[model samples]
Target: MNEDVSDGWAASAVAWIVEQGEDGDYGRRFVLDAPMRARIEGRGFRNALDVGCGEGRFCRIMQRAGIRTTGLDPTEALLARARELDPTGNYRLGRAETMELSAEFDLVVSYLSLIDVPDLGAAIARMVAALRPGGTLLIANLTSFSTAGQPDGWTRDGEGIPRFSIDHYMEERAIWVSWRGIRIQNWHRPLGTYMTLLLDHGLQLRLFVEPEPAGGDPERNAVHRRVPYFHIMEWQKPA
Candidate 1:
């Protein structure tokens, strides 16, 4: 993770935890959970590693599905909270770019965490290295469009419709995002950057989806449908 990003998260950890609660915020509850859980549960993975596991939410989910999961995060406070919440879980203090484990997991996940990483290539290389042969690397990330619209997210037009504007779509940089008392730095990179890096590492794409919100919040779902912000990708390491 970038120094600023790390610092930002460390400072915002408490607010983030409060905002996330036990079930997670609107996006995870409404948009990401079902699809991500379905993909993992159907795969029969023996063991998994969750990069940036934050409070061990997804780790608990995988554990419930009968997959041994290790949750890793660089933030000490969050890891402490995770351990406190799930005392039986394997939670580690670590950064994605420098994780030393290798060939140990059948499934590795980055659930909305890649945006916080500073060295995307190095982090991805470490993730691929950690996977055993035929293992899966699953990712849930903010769409490039969403990141590119940062700093100035949404605006109201003459007709009162929401308009999302994108500028510097191709530039890779970090911007601070604040919401609900949480402020953190997130990296912005073009979509192709992620695709090309994963492909270059010899991982084959298995699934790519832009899941629509299925939760009961009609107003929130409508906004998400108009401009989907998250995408999930599943990739496989060669056997």
Candidate 2:
């Protein structure tokens, strides 16, 4: 992850989450929310990949849902925590846009980490390639360029990693950040944009999730109700 654009919180943030076991406080809050989980579980995917998976929380969830799952992330700390969480879980340390996998997945999904990658098109294209014909690609991210805020900016650190306060929000749906020297980026095409990309890549749109209001857990929900800001996109590769 680029340190300059992400405020130097990319890997440590995941570490904090793994240490705390809390969801939203760290980076996991944006993508792994309950409603999104419901959408993924409802799909009934048999084989799946979790791109930019941090500490493998979503991977564990996928396993419990009976989906055979693997996780991919670039950060060593996050991968270590993920391994600790699920020793048997399959995980690889690599960039999301350039992963190497032999098996095509029934579903390829990403949570909040897309905003940190550097090459959105290459990443999406690679993911599309990793899907089986008629398989699904599920992504969640900040929906609009204007809707989300940008990080501060970039500067070099002692470790030579560019450090910055930047968060990628793109006009054309491509967003990325360079932090402390590491560069991570993602794309956030609107619903139509995703449809077009899917079509161009030989995938078909299946579902699009708009932002929704969050309700209290009643039992003991701690998350304060707020206007939802993320989009959940589901697309399928044609057989």
Candidate 3:
């Protein structure tokens, strides 16, 4: 893992905690949570490892759904908040690039965390290894199109409507972004890069989703109706 990325998260962890607390923002509360929970609630997963589990929000949710969850993150401040949220819960200080747990879990989730991780192949290899045979890996992330086409980079045409400006999207690039107080580095990797990394390990896609806003600020979520902002994918390890 890159030390810069780790340092960046250390700085941003507090603001991230605050954002997670305040209605989970548009993506978390309105779009990602429901569909993820739907797939998780009824499934019988004995144990789950939430990799890059900043603040342990998803771990707590999974615990409520009866899955024994372990939250793993590198940021100390975030882990501290995660511990505060669930005093008795398992929140470990580790990154996905190098994680070893007591045992493999039936479910492993990386929710919007991979963007910060520099080495997708290394990080995900560790993640896949942490899963038991036939286990599932669920990833919720910004699609390459969204990551490559940042609002700041968009150019307006004669009509003043923004048009996406993309260059070298296939090449991995570290892009920095901040909103409110959350400042961090997000990597932009093409779709094929992610697919090849997972498929090379023999994981098979079980479910894929691009969720829409449940119902809230129409203006804030209006773009998602036209283009998918986030994608959720479930991959199963060979049985």
Candidate 2 lDDT tens digits, 1-239: 56424434454555345354834433234333666678668667899999988788878877878899989887767778788878999989888678877547998987766665666667788888788888888887765532333333335688996443323433544445444333445444444554565688867767777654445343222221232346777787888
TM-score of each: 0.97, 0.71, 0.93
What is the per-residue lDDT of model 1 for residues 1-239, given as tens digits with 9 covering 90 to 100? 44434548888889989988889889999899999999998668999999999999999989989999999899988999999999988999999999999799999999999999889999999999999999999999999999999978889889997898889999999988898878898999999999999999999999999999986689889989988999999999999
What lDDT does each candidate get? Answer: 0.93, 0.65, 0.85
RMSD of 2: 8.2
Q: Give the TM-score of candidate 2.
A: 0.71
Which candidate has the highest lDDT of all? 1
Q: Residue-wise lDDT of candidate 3 within 1-239, one digit each (tens)?
A: 54444447877877888888934767889899998898789889889999989888889889989999989988888889988878999889888888876447999999999987888999999998998999999999998888887636557889999666666778788888888897788899998999999999999999888999998789768767766779999999998
Ten residues in sequence with the least summed lDDT for candidate 2? 218-227
